[model samples]
Target chain A: MPAINLLDKFSRFSDQWSPKVIAELNGQAVKLAKVQGTFVWHDHAEEDELFFVVRGTLLIDFEDRETVRLEPGELYVVPRGVRHCPRTEGEEEVWLMLLEPISTKHTGEVEDARTVRTYDRL
Target chain B: MPAINLLDKFSRFSDQWSPKVIAELNGQAVKLAKVQGTFVWHDHAEEDELFFVVRGTLLIDFEDRETVRLEPGELYVVPRGVRHCPRTEGEEEVWLMLLEPISTKHTGEVEDARTVRTYDRL
Candidate 1:
């Protein structure tokens, strides 16, 4: 089978902060997510999340009061146990690949309002 | 800190078949490998591998007699336990991001002649 085209699959989804699994390797799940506005303040206590700007801009807000602005073609890792919230302005959408386990929730903490159980494939 | 720019780091390396650790997400390692010529046939028995072509072209040959050609700005995942070999012709270099564990070898099997310890960062 042909390799999965992440951008092509991402174009099929319009929901923000909803991440979908694109592929999995070695127990690590590669997820594509659309982001606008701001995500919840949570930290992956056991796993570091990778953020790749596939389309628009993404700002990774850290617990240290630092924000890393990511442009297209750029990627960053939010270290394990570090609190962060991602945000972008305007109507532009940000495409990201979160490398974690399939069991990982949208919010690392349980019972959050934005936590999603069933993932959508786009 | 700014997000890691994969292409920028790839520009610093000119050697072929050398994969560098760019970042680690969760328990999985994100590696940047420069590939040319042919790699040894192998398969990750424990984890699936992800290949994102940042430059040049890459051909993934599978044990099932299938071959997938990848171009720049494209990505593919080699499923776990699937035997495969990667190769490229000409002087063109292919930049790839391998999402596996730090313990995973270039050639998945033990006692391989092409195996290298201690990964370098580009």
Candidate 2:
């Protein structure tokens, strides 16, 4: 397989909060997404989600109202069954690398308008 | 858990080829290591290894003589049972983030002087 470039992949799509699969290792898939504004509060029942900030900044808010702010070159892992919502402040776009199981649902058990059931493989 | 800064983690250790576990998620461990010079050729029989270059450059040489060169922000995954060796050229230190099963052995089936049986969790 060829090398996956994060910047090149980010240029492929303009939609926010949608994740595009870039590569799969073992049973986990590596996805890239450009996010802005606020996402819905949701949690995966069985799969843990890993978010790596590639550009800009990201804020992950938990059910307990605790917020974890991540800058470029920082990462955070949300354990399974933990309710969390990811959002970004201002107008700056945040580039994120998400790692989770292939069977993971984008919005977990909550199916809202922003939920992406089928992700494009880049 | 707090946010994990890649640069801060890289600064905690200076040893080469010794992987330090930084976080755990979904039965997998995220490790960081600084490497320079060549490492022994080995392969994980049951686990696939994901290598993400955070600083400098890395050259992964396969047993078939195929080499994959990775730059900063670039990632490559070595499939299971694939014999490969990681090396770096010049005098620069290479910072790497490795993702694999928590039970994965660093040196695979080979045991040499460079093998790290125990890894420090940072």
Chain A: TM-score in each model: 0.89, 0.97
Q: Which stretches of candidate 2 lie over 4 Å from their true place?
A: none
**Tens-digit per-residue lDDT, A20-98, candidate 2:** 9988887999999999999999999999999999999999999775799999999999999999999999999999999
C-alpha lDDT of residue A86 in model 2: 95
- Computed on C-alphas against the true complex, the DockQ of each candidate is 0.70, 0.79
Candidate 1 lDDT over A8-92, as tens digits, reads: 8777887778888877666667788888788788887777678888888998888786799998878888777888889997777
Taking the tens digit of each residue's C-alpha lDDT, what string does model 2 give over B1-122?
89999999888888889999999888899999999999999999999899999889999999775699999888888999999999999998999999999999989999989899888999
Error of 1 at B104 (Å): 0.5
lDDT of 1: 0.78
The Cα error of candidate 2 at residue A7, in Å, is: 1.5
